[model samples]
Target: MSKPLVSVVVISYNHEAFIKQTLDSLLSQKTDFEYEVVVGEDKSTDDTLAICKSYGDKINLIFSEENVGMIPNFIRTLKAAKGKYIAVCEGDDYWIDPLKLQKQVDFLEANPNYTICWTDYSIVNDKGELTKTDFGYTKDIIDIDFNNLFTPYSTYTLTSMFRMEAFDLELYQTLKHYKDNSLYVLLLREGKGAFLNFVSSVYRVHEGGVYSLTSNYHKNYSSYLNIKEIMEAVPESRSKNMKRILNSLGNATAFGLLKQKQKGEVLTEDQLKFMTDYFKNGNLKTKLKYFKRRFLK
Candidate 1:
């Protein structure tokens, strides 16, 4: 077959119940340009590999004999991509709009300044029941640069499509913690991002979901680590924005610890120090809040 214009990477591990739907959603995409679906089945303990194999020659299947974990599988699968544009659809999530890829590719083709494009998405429960719609944003459209990319307003990985050239695979392989947020930062550093108003995918929240199923503490701590990694990965020229992103993440981490303290959990000295460190360079309001939380009964 001729080379595809776009490559879709679907990473699966023990997603036996959901792999079929994920592959189906991807395969069902109606695009004028050619696109390839690359499935990386990370030696799932369940029937995910079998389900992926059932697709046969329809997708470029990469199945491992042993589990390689999420990040490694992601990197290797990405390395296998042979297209100018790259898109991702996790095993649990599925795209709703058949024209999702076409719309995103068209936008990227027209907008040379933007390196990445993502649409709004819906949230669905395990049973595939729609829990919420018009998720991510209410804006008609928005531009995402490095500064705002660290904010709450951001791209959903499964709904995103980005230029292959924008991705730094070497740098990505070096990251200690690999998450979608970090990947977005790496890509945005090359160019800006765009948020299309339409909902094109469904983000599944299930018991097995890595992020959704974690405790608040783990989630908050993970967020802290994610930002820290991004800060370190950014070059010195972008240090100004990195500082801002650090302050934002630090404040959020402190508040997360405070919530845990209020829940009858004692804050460790290390936790308190980490929280206070974030405020040392912060303003008076932030320092006072930290003091009140730290010293006040």
Candidate 2:
């Protein structure tokens, strides 16, 4: 086939049960332009490799001899993409709308100022039953930039399509943990982002899911680390927003540990040190609030 206009990166591991559905959704996209599915099979011990191979030349499959974890696999798959635009749909997630890629590409083509575009999505169970509809937002968020990218709004990876030129491969490689949030911040640094009104994908919440299955502490700590990395990755001019995000993450981590301590969980030395440093570097308001939460209440 000729060179694709868009490249969809699908990272798969032991997702034997859901890989087929994920591939089918991507293969079913009815786009006017050519797009390739670049599958990064991380040496799955299950039937995921066989399942992906069954698609033949329909997808550009890259299987590793040994597992190299998620972030590395993602980076390598991105490196393999030859399209002008790039999209991500992990093996456990599936797109619901057949015109998902078309809509995103149309927006990016028309709006050169925007670096990335993402739509809303639904939450599905392991059985593929819908648990929630329109899971992201009720309205459109059209003016997302680096200054306001770290808000509570959701930008699911499966529903996003971004300009390949906006990606900073060197910066991404430097990050120890490259989460979706990290990618959003990296791309937004180049330009702005857009949140479409319609839901176009289904995010599966199953036992095997990475972030979904992690504990509250692990989730909070992981977010903190991701934000910290983002702060270091961006330019110093963007430090104000990154610092604010880091402070919020620190608050969440500290308060979460405090809650766990109240429930008989012992705080680790590292956790204690984090709380101490968080308060030490915090502003007056943060100190006052922590004082009230710690001493008065």
| Among all candidates shown, the one with the greatest lDDT | 2
Per-residue alpha-carbon lDDT of model 1 for 51-87, expressed as tens digits? 8888889999987688898988988898888889999
- Candidate 1 regions with alpha-carbon error over 4 angstroms: 133-140, 236-245, 258-284
lDDT, residue 142, model 1: 85
Clashing pairs in 1: none
Query: Candidate 1: global Cα-lDDT?
Result: 0.83
Q: How many backbone clashes does candidate 2 have?
A: 0
Separately for all candidates shown, the number of backbone clashes (residues 3 or more apart, or on different chains) is 0, 0
Per-residue alpha-carbon lDDT of model 2 for 114-199, expressed as tens digits? 99988888898877689655334556655777666656556789889999999888878888867898888888888889988788
List residue ranges in candidate 2 displaced over 4 A. Answer: 133-141, 236-243
Report the number of the highest-TM-score candidate. Answer: 2
| Model 1 vs. true fold: TM | 0.89
